[model samples]
Target: MISAPMLDHIVYAVPDLERGVNDIERQVRVRPVSGGTHAGGLTHNALLSLGAGSYLEIIAPVPGSEAPTGALPFGLETLTEPRLVTWAVAVDDIERRIEAARLAGYDPGERMAGGRDLPDGSRLTWQLAVRAEPAGDGIVPFLIHWLSEPHPSGTAPEGCQFVALRAEHPKPESVLRVLRALAVELDVNEGAAPRLIATLETPSGRVELS
Candidate 1:
């Protein structure tokens, strides 16, 4: 059996990266840490530090975009508005994990290297596997492999820590089962309604559901 790994990051898809980051900062009261661009010029990402090698990621496409090189994969093509698209979990070996996913009946595609530019102009690169289908209401996490040296979140900004993460659905246990089947490691449970909730600790106070 495949064992789930640590919670890596959660992704939110927005129409615009700059605007999305600003909006989230306004709500959370902290500027999200920057993550660099992706391969297809789909610029993105702000990192919310969650203690213990985990974090929340908010992603958006760059404005005035060019057409992406390949066919749009699962969540990217279907997303109509800014919302939580998918979460990612870390693995010791991305290649091995991809094989495991394939054996378990998920056709995770080839590994792709992508990058994002930081606000300060520095760039960071990472790897990911795009799935053929949306993982059912964004509850299922896509796989990610961080290729950059030392991993992103190694030196997280001060005043941030991941407290707990929760996912809510009418069939909460079912959702957990899917996540488990995908080998994602986290403690997930039902919420008040059919929604996913993530809790964070910041300098200001505790924040929930980003």
Candidate 2:
């Protein structure tokens, strides 16, 4: 089980934004709040609180938006259904963390700034580190440093508690090695494919989302 203190937020990607929100609400019994649109108009998102400091991000294509200028983040364009695509970990000095990971044989790419407009006319800004290739196919977490105050979790819809996180990968050892380099720990099991499994305590009772 991964520690909650080190966990930031988990990403749930879908092909249709509103449909995904409804499906997740039906399962968890908690409606998500609008988190607002991203830069490029390629995607938009809604947020659900996963207890203090952490949340679940439901991301998808912005309806009627222009064609993507390039490949979308997290492969949202081709997802067949809603899936636990990846996750992020809050960190300080993200650039330093990226350098440290590279020294340990894993490169988390470079620090990049990102922001989205909030519903209240304010903007939420942050910097993140992501690899050109998905880090361990999205099992290993990326790094994020929030530049804004009073994190999104504080204002998101509540009632879900993040319980545990783990993964299944055909090559567990390789994934573990990268996690070690980043100083993060996770329960991983050998399996046929790479998948992230998150256990949560929702109003609907205990549930697993992957």
Candidate 3:
């Protein structure tokens, strides 16, 4: 059976990287760690350490850039602004987990190689399955593997804490089931509206459901 290991990161799609980063910093009170650029000109990434082997990420397409060199691996092109788009869950063995997911009746998609630039001008490479499309109504989460590197959270900025997570519609219990079935450790609360919310405690202040 496919088992999710741990919560990886939450993603937010924005129109501008700088603007998004700035806004997130102001709200969270801590600047996110730069994650470099993607294949296309869609440069992005802000890493917020969420403690306990987890973190939050804000992603967006860089303006005036080409549509991405090859194909739009993940259905990232279809995402709207400020929406909770994609997320990752850690796995001990990616290949084994992929096979398990296939057995669980998920397409599992194709494996792709991608790189992210660090703040110090260094680059990191990793591989993961590209979802054919964004998880509609926030039902699904994008699966990922970190290749051969440790999760960035272990070394991300200090004083960042993952305060809380909220999900809308579709029921957080249902979502929690999928995550649990995947072997991920998530504490979800039901009986509330459908909205995936995450609160972050940063060095500067607190960021709630943003």
Candidate 4:
């Protein structure tokens, strides 16, 4: 088994951002605050604080936004349901980790840079290494490296903590191997389909999102 990475955040993709915000608010009792738009202008998100240096991002493609070419990350365009489509993990040195991953037989793709403009007019720039194909419909995580800036998770609306994060897949062992390669560990249970289930403790007790 390879070493997996630490959890940075999870991505919940929806077609409409406002609707998703309402859904999470009603279910979790915590409103996600606007995090801003992606550099490609293809998607935007709101964030909720999940204690312990982690957070959740409810992302949706901006209405009428155009990604002229190439694939949008996280499969934002294809998401029909507000589901957990993908996740990210922090890396101390992205290039070094990329080389390591390649040597291990996994090409996580090249380091790409982008940023989003916050409501306050400030930009949160970051560089990430996203795999060409997010296997298992994003059950696998891409890599991220924040460029000397404060992470958004720390400043999000506070009131929740991740209780558990798990994976359900028929071929659990194979998925577990890829997760370990990224240095991420999630409890796996056999199931017909692959999905991620995240449990968060909030003022409303507990909220589970998959």
- Best prediction by TM-score: 2
lDDT, candidate 1, 99-203, per-residue tens: 887787665668877666666676667777766564546666777777675556665454567666556566667766666566665555556654556666776
**23-78: candidate 4 lDDT, tens digit per residue:** 99998888999998874677889999887778899998898886777446677767
Those runs of model 4 whose alpha carbons end farther than 4 Å from true positions after fitting are: 1-5
- Each model's total of backbone clashes: 8, 0, 12, 6
Candidate 2 C-alpha lDDT tens digits along 1-210: 786898899999999988999999999999998999885667899999998699999999886665545567788666778889889999989988998898998888889999998878888899999876786789999999999977988999999999999999999999999999988899989999999999999999998999
Superposed Cα deviation of residue 8, candidate 1 (Å): 1.6
Cα RMSD, model 3: 4.1
Error of 2 at 35 (Å): 0.5
TM-score per candidate, in order? Answer: 0.76, 0.96, 0.76, 0.92
lDDT tens string, model 3, 1-210?
112234677777676667777887787777777776766546567776778878777776655655735333233555456665556766556777767767665555577776787767766777776466533344456567786565777766657777665555536665655554454444555544445566767776776653
Question: Which rank order by TM-score, best down to worst?
Answer: 2, 4, 3, 1
Checking candidate 2 for backbone clashes, the offending pairs are none
Candidate that beats the other on TM-score, 3 or 4, i.e. the better one: 4
lDDT of prediction 4: 0.80
Model 4, poorest ten-residue lDDT window?
Answer: 1-10
Candidate 2 or 3, higher lDDT? 2
State the C-alpha lDDT per candidate.
0.64, 0.89, 0.62, 0.80
TM-score for predicted model 1 compared with the true structure: 0.76
